[model samples]
Target: MQAPEFLAAHAAEAERAIAQVLDDRASVVPERLLEAMRYSLMAGGKRVRPALVRECYRACGGVDDARVLPAMMAIEAIHTYSLIHDDLPCMDDDDVRRGSPTCHRRFDEATAVLAADALQALAFELLASADIEAELRCELIRRLALAAGCQGMVGGQMMDMQAEDGSGIDLMQVERIHLHKTGALLCWCCEAGALLAGAGSDQLDACSRYGKAVGLLFQIADDILDATASSETLGKSAGKDAAQHKATYVSVLGLVPARELAAEMLELAIAAGSTLGEGGQPLNTLAQYIMGRDR
Candidate 1:
């Protein structure tokens, strides 16, 4: 299937699964809190991360969504939690997200924070209770914890906050920040899929290489979009990086150079995916889509 079609199909599945997960918890979760969580979680985007889990699983010979859907739901939940916290007053302070009022704006700051916390906990629960074997489930939980914790996304976020308007920053430093902040979770999505499928070492390595390249490629495209796209186009605040003097590919390498680098990363990702033969085509096409995405 084509990348767009594949993403759309898997995104639909992920949406349904997410809604069911939330609905299952409706009785126990506070009404207002559940409403707040649903507000942000249902706010739609491309669902790229979950789709990656499915694609990587399929690419590695996994035949069933049952093997990977838990990972998909877990990643999306983690992603949604991150977005909620990232939009908090102390963070990006953005009023808009996915073309709607941000969680903190639509709800109160406390509600948004609690909603994010609940989602984070829920993500772990999904992984821990996944129908897979105990050892595999443990591995997934460990990897996800590492990806979401101080060593990964959180550390990257701290670096990003500290690098704002700071002088003497370099390209390597900016890449380090992005690798953690945004790339870590993306890389995990790919790795999780491969693991869920019981892929061979060669396939796993290919997935890892593709994940790393695509992860950086994704952030570079985001930087370009933030620099060049409009708020309506992005469905959120644009040009905030420049406004806040945040370190980014465009900031460190200039717009044209950053775009060139994105192209390079795309090629690198494609090359890695190519090693997987037919199963890797979707990954390659997804890389192209990411490079060309305006938002």
Candidate 2:
């Protein structure tokens, strides 16, 4: 399949799996909280994280997607939870996300906050309860916690908030912030796939390298889009970074240079995946899609 078709296929499977997971929990979850969770969880985006998990597994010679379904579900839950919190008044304070009103705006701040918390817990729950072997499950949970917790995505977010003042910031600082904030979880996705597939060391190394490069590339692409794309195209407020004086690749390096950096990262990502031979085709395609995505 082509890139759009591949992404859409993976995204559809992810949503189906997500809905089943939510349905299984509907019996105990409060109606309002569940609704809030569903509003954002089901809200359509590229589902890139889940796709990464699935594709990386395939790249590692994993045949059955079902084997990694829980991992896919777990990663997306954490990703969506982050988005909900990120859109709160205390964070980006945006009213729109995925072309819909944000969780806090659609429901209420308390509901949004509670829903995000519940989803965070749910991510671990899914992994802990998966049918995978005990050792693998534990490893997945541990890695995910490290990725989503203070040492990873959360830390990067804190750095981003601190950098909003735009004082004494440089390109290295910007890269560091994004590596933790965006790159950590992405790296986890790749690692989770390889681990699930029981990939050899070489395949594992390639995925890790690809994930790191793509992580930075993804953020740089977002910076470019935020600078150039309209809110209609972006499905969120445009120029918020500039308005907020946030440090980004575009802010540190000029737009032209930022694009150059993204190109360099793209090559790195593709070359890393090349080590997998035919199994790496999907990964290369996905990296190209990330670089060229309009939103």
Candidate 3:
């Protein structure tokens, strides 16, 4: 399949895993909270992270997407939860996400907060409860927790908040924030996929390197888009970063340079993916998409 077609197919598979995981727990979850979770979790987007998980597994010679289905769901769930909290009034304060009202905007603030919290816990629960070998389960849980914890995404967020005034920051500092805030979870997705697939150290290392490049690429793309794209086109507020004077690639390096950096990262990601040979096409394509995406 071609790039768009391949990504679309994998996105569908990710959504299917998300649906099955949520549907199975509907009986036990509270109705309103479930609806809140559904609102964001089901909101259509690229499903890039879960797709990476599945694609990395395949690239590592694992034929079964189901083998990593739970991991896919868990990764996506954690991502969705992060979005919910990120768009809170105290954070990005965004009204829209993926072209619709954000979780807090769609539901009450408390509901959004609680739902996000629940989704975070649910991700670990899925990992811990999966039918995989105990060691694999433990490893997934341990890595995911670190990726999502204070030293990773949360720490990056704190740095982001501190940097919003736009003074006393450099490109390196901005990249550090991007690495912690965005790169960690993405790295986990790629590594976790290979780990679950029983890939050797070399394959795992290849995927991990690809993830690191893609993670930076993802944030750089966002920075580029924020400076150039319309809110309508982006499915969320645009130019808000500049308005807030926040330090981003676009803010620190300018649009042209940011785009150039993103290209470099994409090329690096593709090179890393090439190490996986033919099965790595999906990852290479996804990396290209990260650079080319307008929204």
Candidate 4:
């Protein structure tokens, strides 16, 4: 299938799965918080992470078992939660996401925070409650916790925050921040997908390498978008990173250099996909799609 059609199909599947898991109409104990969670979760994006999981499983010759769906949902939930918190007044302080009002903007600050926390907890809960093998479930939980916690995304966020005050950050520092904050979860998505598909160490390593290259490329593309895209096209505040004085590739390296770097990373990602042989072509196509995405 073409990239657009493939993405559309996977995005639909992801939305269905998320709705099924989050459809607790039982009085809404958390009421506003639940609304906030739904608000952000349902707000449309590429659904790339969940699609990565599904694609990776397919690449590994795995069947579409029910057990894989929970992991996919949990990853997306975690990603949405991160976006919610990242848009808080204390974080990116944005008013928009996916062309809609941010969670904090739509709901109150407290509700947004509560929703993010709830989503984070729900991610772990889903992993624990899934009908997968006990050992596999445990490993998934551990990997996700590590990726989402201090050692990964949280740590990267801290680095970003610290660098926001005109702090001098080199290319390496910028890469590290993105690798931890963004790349880690992406890597987890690929690794977890392979694991769910019963892949061996070699396959897992290939996925990890693919994730690393694509993750960095994705961030580089974001920098380019911020530099060139309009808010209408981006579906969020463009130039917010520059406005915040965040250390980005375009900030440190010139826009031309940043674009070059992104191209290099994309090449690396495609090369990594080659290690998966024929089954990896979809991944290569995904890398190209991400690099060329208008939104």
RMSD of each: 1.4, 1.3, 1.6, 1.5
Q: Write the residue-wise lDDT of candidate 2 on 101-154 in tens digits.
A: 999999999999999999999899999999989999999999999999999999
Error of 3 at 85 (Å): 0.7
Task: Write the candidate numbers in order of decreasing lDDT.
Answer: 2, 1, 3, 4
lDDT of 1 by residue, 1-295 (tens): 2347888888888879989988998789899999998898889988889988988888898998878998999998999999999999999899999899999999999999999999999899999999999999999999999999999999999998899859678999999998999899999999999999999999999888988999999999999999999999889989999998888899889999999999999999999898988998999888899989777
Q: Model 3 lDDT vs. the true structure?
A: 0.90
Question: What's the TM-score of each model vs. the native?
Answer: 0.98, 0.98, 0.96, 0.96
Clashes of each: 0, 0, 0, 0
Clashes of 2: 0
Candidate 3 residue runs with Cα over 4 Å from true position: 1-3
- The better candidate by lDDT, 3 or 4, is 3
lDDT of 2: 0.92
* Global lDDT scores for all candidate models: 0.91, 0.92, 0.90, 0.88
Pull out the clashing pairs in model 2.
none
Question: Candidate 3, residues 116-204: lDDT per residue as tens digits?
Answer: 99999989998998888999999999999999999999999999999997577999999999899999999999999899889999999
Candidate 1's C-alpha lDDT? Answer: 0.91
TM-score of 2: 0.98
Task: Please tell me which predicted candidate would have the highest lDDT against the true structure.
Answer: 2
True lDDT of residue 98, candidate 3:
90
How many steric clashes does model 1 contain? 0
Q: Looking at candidate 1, what is the lDDT of residue 121?
A: 96
Please state the error at residue 289 of candidate 3 in Å.
1.0
